[model samples]
Target: MEPIYKISTKKIRLLLAAVVIPCLIISITRLYYCDKVEYVRPLALEGEMQLRNDRFGDGHYAARRAGGKRHAGVDILADLDTPVIAIRGGRARALIDEDGFGNYIIITHWDETKSLYGHLSRVLLPPLGFVRQGDVIGEVGKTGNANYKSMKAHMHFEIRRKGKTIDPTFIMEAENIKK
Candidate 1:
């Protein structure tokens, strides 16, 4: 009996290449975007902290400012004075009140990565002070651009690598740390 169809070696190789190449490319892309790093929740409290705004492409990050500047971080809706902590061990690079970030603290991690905690009601650590992971750093509030009568209090958080903004959700999720 003759087979109705016979697959040639070249055809088999081409079939495998079509499937394998795309899979490899997809895996590499996923790894680049979803790579995990050592990080913890900035807030120690349990339960789901509603996202007021997410990183770029959603929420304030997508909205342009007066000069067409987009929001640079995620905003986690929380009550006024909610405790904020360091996502990793780092030094408090700057702690100040500004027109945009309000009261914010920039923590420079050992890897040169930085985390910004903004819209804070209070800054606990002094500039250049070291902070341990999970240590209390500040309390959330509607400071800076968040100070609107209709705007609920929240924490605007940002993760930066070499001064470039990266999604904080990716870092938090990679560590399985809930926001």
Candidate 2:
């Protein structure tokens, strides 16, 4: 008696080539273009971020605040109406205008991290908003708890993961290069 069965090496090789070749090409492309990826500053700044007591924790993360509260993010001081750009590609998750943050937008980034751009003089994104890295979403303004004639025009920027605020300097370009 003889067994009726067939196995072929050619078909297996073809199948593997079809699937694996594309994946290899994709990986190589990403590795080659990785240097092109950039994170944008929220606004233009003239100098290094000085660790100062702007009283309400100004630009320092975890700095002491009034009433013994701690600051959660950095404040980038700038001229009023200066454009604010997205740090990374993301969707506009929430657009809120209120007293605490004045006008703010919460963006849900591709990496499952969220960034909050607060104290905006104006929000430029649409309601059904999706934004790319470095797109203008708002402008620097003294709003929220920052609204005071004595206060400098600035924006409160925060990067959050798992609903908790993280230091944005871990990934952001600290200096706003003059170009």
Candidate 3:
């Protein structure tokens, strides 16, 4: 007999299909979830009162003399001591007590946008250097120098874009939640 030669075309095609199929699936799934922003509104008052703020009406900014004071946050209405939760998956960047915002927690999301939960009555620290989505950052209260009491005790939620405050309402819409 001469030299025996065999090539399995079926085997080659099967190998290619197996590799290609999984690659396609992974690519599609990645595009679906990559850097997509997710959020949950601050706790409602017994699920009755909706979130609001007198400082800036929904989709509007408070005017300032320095320039147009674009409202950079969405206010979430909660009881005087309701817990404020993270709206997206990320780590805690900073939690600061200040004059205007009072005690606040800054949570960073995958998209690089930072969610600021402010005017909190109290904040629970995560080992002083750790936090995650759905973590309770603080309790709502009127602590800031701002007139939080007259406005109602709630979480002042702000989403910063490139370090600038834009209407957080736009972000809520992008995340597809009704204001």
TM-score for each predicted model, relative to the true structure: 0.69, 0.70, 0.61
Stretches of candidate 2 off by over 4 Å are 1-38, 45-52, 172-179
Q: Per-residue CA lDDT of candidate 1, range 1-179, in tens?
A: 99999999999998898676632222321211111236677876676556774332244444564577776777787889989988877667555666778989888766678899998998898444867677789999888878888787888889889889976766545646635
lDDT of each: 0.72, 0.70, 0.60
Model 3: CA > 4 A from native: 1-37, 44-68, 147-151, 170-179
Clashing pairs in 1: none
Q: RMSD, model 1, all Cα superposed?
A: 12.4
Model 1 has an lDDT value of: 0.72
Model 1 off-target regions past 4 Å?
Answer: 1-37, 53-67, 126-128
lDDT of 1 at 128: 43
TM-score of the candidate numbered 1? 0.69
Worst 10 residues of 3 by lDDT: 25-34
RMSD of each: 12.4, 7.6, 8.6
Of candidate 1, the 10-residue stretch with the lowest lDDT total is 28-37
